[model samples]
Target chain A: MSKQVFIPRDSLNQALERLSSKMNVWVPAASGSNKCGSEFVPYRPDLIPLLNRQTTTPPKAVVFPQVETLLSYEYTKDPDNPSRVKIQLDDTSAGSPTLIFGARPCDARGFLLFDQVFTRGPFTDKYYRDRRENSYFATLVCLEWDSACFCSSVGSGPTDMEGSDLRVTPLKDGYLVEALNERAEPILSLMEGDVPTDAQQQDARKLQEEASRQRVGNVDLTRSATDFKGRFEDKAYWRAMVSQCLSCGVCTFVCPTCYCFSITDEMQGLKGERLRSWDSCMFFQYTLEASGHNPRPTRFERYRNRVGHKFSFIPEKYNGMIGCCGCGRCIRSCPVSIDIRRVVENLKENACVCA
Target chain B: MEASATTRLHQEVEASIGRLSTVLGWGAGYDPLHMTPLFVRSPEDIARLVWNPLCVQNLTGYLVKSPGVQPPEEGKKIGICVRGCDSRSLVALIQEKLISRENLYIIGIPCRGTVDIRRLMNESGLSNIRSVRIEKDLLIVDDANGAHNLPLERFLARRCLRCRHPNPVIHDVLLDEPVTPRTTAEDAYRDVESLEAQSLDQRRAFWSVELDRCLRCYACRNACPLCICQNRCIAETRDPRWLTQRVNLPEKFLYHFIHALHLAGRCTECGECERVCPMEIPVTLIKEKLNQITRDLLHYEAGLDPEAVPPLLTFNPAEAGI
Candidate 1:
């Protein structure tokens, strides 16, 4: 058996506390006092982290928060020439080194899409780039697959190690933590655990094997882009699929892979700050042009774009990296439970033909 | 097996689909614990219709919201399924003239409290569940690992616990025998009262933490049946500039208060706002507090009598104890 570091469940918080002195340690914590809602939060002494199940909100906020100030600006007028305004800007929102302690593999995989848009592009967003580069993910090998999780269907799995700096596997009494690369090596010592016994290592291996073997769904989305293209003009098909959708931003807000945002200047008199907040394609204002015409006027067209962007357009544009991570937050958090998997599958098979 | 109550309801909807444009109901989701709002257009679609404790969604919003089921022709009407709480929303819509009574065919189900799936899952440690069914007072959950029977009373939603109207106040057709209400009108605001009994600072602290967690997804506003200002909502409109895009605690507090105050006396306590909240914030509690104030000051309850206008909507100078 390979030797590995094991952090006992009891002392896991102590190790995390020790790590926090070095950098911000984010863990999957209950949103309030209830376990029903979970999000990645900066670790505190009293906070009991949730490592058992998938969090309600992803760790995307670590790199790209829902709403953040891009820059603060102020306007000043000279006494002699009041008409001439001087603009002073402050871009002080620098990112600190962060360690997301209990991110799932699907959560880690979502950053790859962000990297494609923010880092690999010609005009890089400095705020996102700094956070993306400084953040390291200790992804947990997900053993608890609910109906909402479809990581395997989207080319990611419970143990899929893409974009993960460290691998954390839960054992009965502790977690077997291992650094996948050199950058992650230092954090292992910060976990402050003893080397795993042969028996403990064997047990973790068995769990790893079990997690890798599990399958969530059998649907093949290999021909999704082409199929979606074929049915792009079928308005009736799209209408039937998402008729129950409430057109709320829950799906996109909870999604780890949805990286769309809108920038606006929030001003209080002469003092102003540019803010970047999360935006959803489901809303009417998303496609509203300056000419007062909206291309995606209704929920039907907007929802169609949502499906097309993830399965068809993103893959075609980004060299075959589908925008969806299939973390299943879109399905789980949808007020009406409009399954994206079902919609994508139906894109290939026209609803008219079946009904 | 005998035809269940849900199956019988589906049979009735199948027969009525010939005279209706579409029937709004609940269908099976990816799992048994969750239910999706189903829109049935044809006879074949009626089979998807379900009526059970898991059918927790309040479907009245679809009448006024997106892809609404209006009359296809002048003569034909639209069909809708409503629980006791949902029927109240339906009544409120009719009272406001958002939907006319003549254009609807209502299918009412007297609800005996729906399960709080999140709470049930949390307390029971049930995940990836296979099936959930009601057997009298117990809820049987099949999670592949084992079958666990949980008491139904322990998992009821907080709104359902305080429900004073378990039977539909307005319905063209009643599906089941009406059940007795769990609480009286005088004690219906017990939960809100407990929160009120706390010191003002304590309540403020509680809401400060709860509202701070808001992602500003606007799910609560979207799910509410009384919020008819869909695209023109002030919360999203930058032209008027009531609030900024900043998601700080102050912005969240303003947004929630605006949502609750907009419903003042119109909110029927359907609990859809609380149900749809992804963060599990008890947003409906805010609206209920408004309803309590309206109740005491005006001696009124919304949606019980469609003919009576909400006191807040109209100016009555002669209103007692003003």
Candidate 2:
């Protein structure tokens, strides 16, 4: 437990402004072209965070960028031996401390799964480790849940603060802010807030208590590793479920915990860069072989791999830690509204039957 | 629509579906303001079919894209539901011979406009919505709070505001009496005109800011009915090497160019690309500008006549030798 304080709603921007001067701060801001959507951007003096709604894209990029340069290289002709050429390598990793404000609890929880892959690896990924160790999360105690949200079903909830460094609970006209870790304590002073009154403290507790009990999604998604494994070979089942899928990358791109990537070498003259970019198993090219043989040749097979990788493969590999945090961005942003909750829940039972 | 109208539509559609390979239509989604495309092969699923301003997706892509509607068996037809804008895609597909006209049973619905759920949520601050329906010129939304009435025209999609084809150009079964179009053809390119009014630098800045937010999820391309390349799209191909995997502004700009330019003379302006974009980047404006140029320079309109070839694709033998 840490100290608690209250920052009025109007002063929230001032607190973020001050935090930005100390370290990199990301706040959810409305897109220039559309007011209905938002993305995380660096905080400026006049920037106001969209506290009411979730961002279209998560702050996952702050720790692991969408596209990252692993290393840069240049080839030069050797002076002493003309037949041999010299290769110069430059390390591209430059770690910096960052703070992500206004992240939903589900959004913050995504990092835990990422940590499992990047930090506890057979060989620790230096690029991911550098950013992961230096970043802090100031997650909001989520008060809203819609049809797509299912954090509670995934062993987490709206008020689940397992991965957050700071927990911010919304109040009537202000916020009740609490530091959950020593690294986040310094930010409370930066908020320039007053001590919460007894009434305000009660309000904060009631909100979290109510949220904790709420059923965001009416399904149990945990313990699905066996169910998924049992049905992996049921080709008829998989085909029926994914017949309507467009095989677009929307679901993977919007997912907070989906971290699959492909590395490519981009060359220009004498210099070249080794880059890593996000990849989706839904696409046909994701598993295309050099000889033009594709292991997952059809869209249904690709989609099955995606579902398996999240629920079954990760648990089999990582001691039962689920790959999904269930922020539901994938569901909400999907053009066809393919509900993943329905798919995962129905994993325990037969969803569709055909001849 | 009136309750009787909905009933009549369902009954008629249900009666005609016995011989179709599949009947493509809209079904209830996770929420009131969302709808999903449904392929109805049985009478039980017909009850799930719905029609409203919330029906936003253009389902014509299923006719041509793989894993979509498969080719009908000999002498069988593929049933589809199309609004005013979707009908144009059918004509374009027929014009290019992508889908035979004789093999379709189109149930056409006259459209006023489809609601933009994002715009409605942003403007009304509405959340936890339980129900939404249209009554005359107003949209009635019900949430945890009581019902709130809003003017429908102001909340219509940006593309809908300038719609010049509210009546399906071609149809086998017309659902309703045709409604008046929102704008005349002269005012059709108003969105492009405003963008053109800006200086060159201003235009560049506008696009730079918008494209910088693209995730390259390819939702817009997949949603487009005329983007027929599918798995062979140039944006994803290594053989052509047109683009890298970089998520920077230059790569994003080029990808948008590939999407817009490929449909330069063929875009039906259904607004699916703009609607499906999670970033809400107003991508349709890029295609609209090209459409304006095609209309002015080539003196042509696409998806209007099934037999007419697009100006860009029309062959000139004397110039082709070069």
Candidate 3:
């Protein structure tokens, strides 16, 4: 039987501290006093996690960081041969046991897509694999959602527990926690709380049921890919849809499923490091070939590719599972207010006419 | 007065819709508190246009963006709405000959101050807003919970706090009477001055902390009207690569420096770079410092005079001292 426990409101910090002691823990916290938004930060005793709201920046950095050093190298003159140089390589992995507390279901679901790309492929990324094997998620059953949230439309919901190791539902005075998998068993044992009463379990169940029924967005995007491909050649449609698009990477940066990255070697004299960082298809350089030919030249082609990659291309490759998790960060963070749902829905309307 | 301004704007746009291939204006977004750029092709779409404090975007950047609003086949013009700051961007573009003045029909609106949605939400603690309206110097926000009345200054954008040009510099059709500027030129550089007062180490520490959070989304670059090298930006070029793919502090600092230096004499103080930043970094301050240098050394201000060339773009052979 799965273990169930209740961590009272006052004891929440204590529970987090205990969890941190056992493993590296991360929680959604405000970036700073001057900044208006929050992001996933390493847990500290004084840091109060913003559990009620979605983080402005997703927790993808925990696994796929914005910048990570793949390896470092140094060159030195060899004593045996003056003409030849000796090379020293730094190739140590930094993965450790980690616990991500209070992640929303949408944030946790992002890892499922990452797993498909990094873990299930022939060329598995050792860095991503190491982090994936060591981390655990204690996702909160999300009841709070904004207009930007459309988790329900893309086959996910506020209360979906597809990838959570443990499920937590806030109650009147405490949070009811249920261990969903074996990874959460040790943490559950360390938690100093009483087993949740039968009545409390019923309350959590009711909250989950209501949250699942709530509709976040109105659009049904099951066949979004097919519709997008049908209108691929319609330049007028693309122009009208994304005319105000700043051609910036805000949408992709805030998106939970976007995993495009670029690698480069940074050197200063005899020392150098190979680094990998997040990249966006919205950028003009994303498709710039070494020979100076770019297939996706303008923002029109780039925007179309972004929509296609998520809804059409990924689904075709990944057994009809759409790449977008529908967390609504793209819509919320867009400087021009370009709604993806509206764009995808419009795709179906203009396809037949254009063809 | 505001109601008449809105009416006048609508009538002017409606009148020009037939002669113009497209009319660029603001429309209601997902919510009433937000406004998105509206592309009005026909007279029917003109009804969608609205003018209010929520119209914060500097729409002039669209004039230079690729695959932009095309001109009609039979010598028709393109109509665009410009606020005080936006008109300056248009002026800068026109001065650079990026767009022809004859092809554009400018409908200029006198702006009191545009609302910063982040600041408004923080001040009022209001979200899920149903509607928002500006009455005199007060912002009234209504949500499902209740209504909130906030002082306009408390929720004004950082750019509006020191706005020196509330009235457009040039316009084909003026939408309303000129509005008084919110601040004087003297009070414009207080934020920059305060930063200058700090020690070099303190300033370095401050910037390091701020720029460390940048996701390198490039929203700041894309929103800027002066940054014309859109697809061929030096930051992304490989042959003479100025910046690496590394997201370190040094790379971030250098990238920002390149951006600032490129806009040294050309920036129109539109505040689009700072406004569009997701991390809310005060990016405009960098450009402001450069503008201050140009103002002091060359006695020049950008986007003010269409005939005057940018200080750096043209050289004065007789200029001595160097």
Best candidate (score: DockQ): 1
In Å, residue B64's CA in model 3 sits off its true spot by 1.4
Badly placed stretches (over 4 Å) of model 1 are: A1-4, A350-355, B1-3
Model 1 DockQ vs. reference: 0.70
Best by lDDT: 1
TM-scores for the candidates: 0.97, 0.95, 0.94
TM-score of chain A of 1: 0.96
The count of backbone overlaps in candidate 2 is 0
Task: Write model 1 residue lDDT over B195-257, tens digit each, in one string.
Answer: 999999999998998899888899999889999899888898888989899899999999999
Across residues A45-128, which tens digit of lDDT does each residue of candidate 1 receive?
999989988899999888998889999999999989999999999987678889999999889999999999888888988999
Put down candidate 3 lDDT per residue, A130-165, tens digits, no spaces: 988888889999988776788888898888899889
In candidate 3, the second chain superimposes onto the true chain B with a TM-score of 0.96
RMSD of each: 1.8, 2.4, 2.6
Task: List residue ranges in candidate 3 displaced over 4 A.
Answer: A73-94, A197-202, A350-355, B1-4, B71-74, B134-138, B317-322
Pairs in steric clash, model 2: none
Candidate 3 C-alpha lDDT tens digits along B1-322: 4456677888898777778988889887767777889888878787778898888888888888786677554878888899899999988899999988898889989998888887666556676777777777787878868988887777788898888988888788888889899888778888899999999999999999999888888899999988989877888776577888877888888888899999998998989899999888889999999988887778888888888899888888976422
Is candidate 1 or 3 superior in TM-score? 1
